[model samples]
Target: MDHATPRVKATLSDEGQRLFDLFRRPQGRSRPRPGERAAMEGARWGRLTVGDTAVVTYRWGDGARPVLLVHGWESRASRYAKVVTRLLELGYSPLAFDAPGHGESAGDSTTLIEYRDAIVQLHEAHGPFEAVVAHSFGVTASFLALRDGVRARRVVAISSVPDFGYVVDAFCARTGLTPRLRDELRHRIERNLYPGEADLWTRFSVLTGAADPRPPLLLVHDEDDEVVGPEQARRIAAAYGERARTLTTRRFGHRRILGSPPLVAAVGDFVSTGAVSGGLPGAEAAR
Candidate 1:
């Protein structure tokens, strides 16, 4: 438990209101650091509205093969700057956006359903993508979208979160939430956020969300990823069998994997492998 857990436990009320509030909102938004800013340069900027929230969107190239870039929780789209550059070199158009409640988006809190909606809308507006490149929580949101009918030829998941329950469990474990409070939080999630969807935890999972005969997947995870364990990738690959591939690395941890040159090159190469070259036919429509 961190310093706040004992105090929170002592002050807990009947409703477990404080715990619910903390669960609902991310601690903070991620911004581009000085060294990361250059990767964000020269992109067309636009806004996408997800339920009254204005999500910030960016497009990096006009290559015919559109590849969607999805960043993890507490991360901004610009964090994929290096990957974006690599995609551009391979003649693949890269599109990305800040999800509701994160980065430049207009919200302080968001849910998986909201993230799925944003992604599906983007695909409807600009896609039929060649592939999807997602990191951490983005893997979950993207998988949910794919299950909900957003189509992509291939998927690259970096530091993947295997399921929704894992997220809750990890959070509770990290914060040292009491067992009673954790149960209450789970009940509140089901009752408030997803009424009538009793199987949401399973349905929203990256492992099970993409049903059988699923799209080809590339699972990348660092052995030392403290945030999301490396074993998550092994489980996904095992489930998908031959449809999925793995790239295991060391020392990169959760976030640094996005910036690794060799890894980004491999991802770009994987995404562009048989993708045809040229400007996207409906490129102008996205405007």
Candidate 2:
């Protein structure tokens, strides 16, 4: 593929293909919790440097085992507000942060590396964490970090792309890009990696290191989610063997999974025990 790099360069030279490019800067900033706001009539924010980029964010919760709440693509950490409150109420400390180029983080563009490093660093600062509750794109970086050797007791992937190649192909199909750009995208993945990465594709998947199973995982997905397919969630469960458990819901769309009572209960149960709650659609699940 070294010979293919020149053509890859030419393919990405198109300045007009905006859809192929990811959003470089963060969109929404976080707001303080209702209690925090009510108490002080103010909000707080902070920053941490991962690698060279500064990730601006916030932290909250109160429990023996800390939980990291990671938000999805084009979304802020504040979206997991319910998860934070629920975990906190349950006596678990939940730390939420903005991925570079997603929330209030300081960066024009972000990459999977930055996100993974941020999680690792945060875990180091406020660990040893019990689990990481990640959504969408956060799942990608979480997989990379956990697979690459970030210590965690558990990982919860919500609405994640099971395969990076699949997500790329889906985006390529949606944007109507030529197959040639796919090769260039592969080149970008190559660039995204260190000089010695043996396989770019496996390097991006959590499944690579998941087989050994250092930490158990619970994958929650919405069957009707138009964003990330349910197949991804199933693939994740299958990869983890008995260590991974999944619960699918038809009603909650992509964003609602975090706030849904059933999902929250299932996550709570899964974290406490390895068993996953079988809460079918329209069933009465706990809040």
The alpha-carbon root-mean-square deviation between model 2 and the true structure, to one decimal in Å, is 5.1
lDDT of 2 by residue, 1-287 (tens): 99899886665666324433442334454454453343222124668897777887676643358888777666777667666666766677777787776656766566677788888888777877788889888888888877666777888888886756666777667767677766665566565433456776777776677767468777788888888888887777777787767777777888767677777776676666666656554423221
TM-score for each of the candidates? 0.88, 0.82
Tens digits of per-residue lDDT for model 1 on 92-189?
89999998888888999888888898889889988898999999989998999998899999998899999889989998998898888889889888
For candidate 1, report its TM-score: 0.88
Best by lDDT: 1
lDDT of 2: 0.69
Q: What residue runs in model 1 are displaced by over 4 Å at the alpha carbon?
A: 1-11, 209-211, 274-287
Colliding pairs, model 1: none
The prediction achieving the highest TM-score against the true structure is 1
Q: How many backbone clashes does candidate 1 have?
A: 0
lDDT of each: 0.82, 0.69
Q: What is candidate 2's TM-score against the reference? A: 0.82
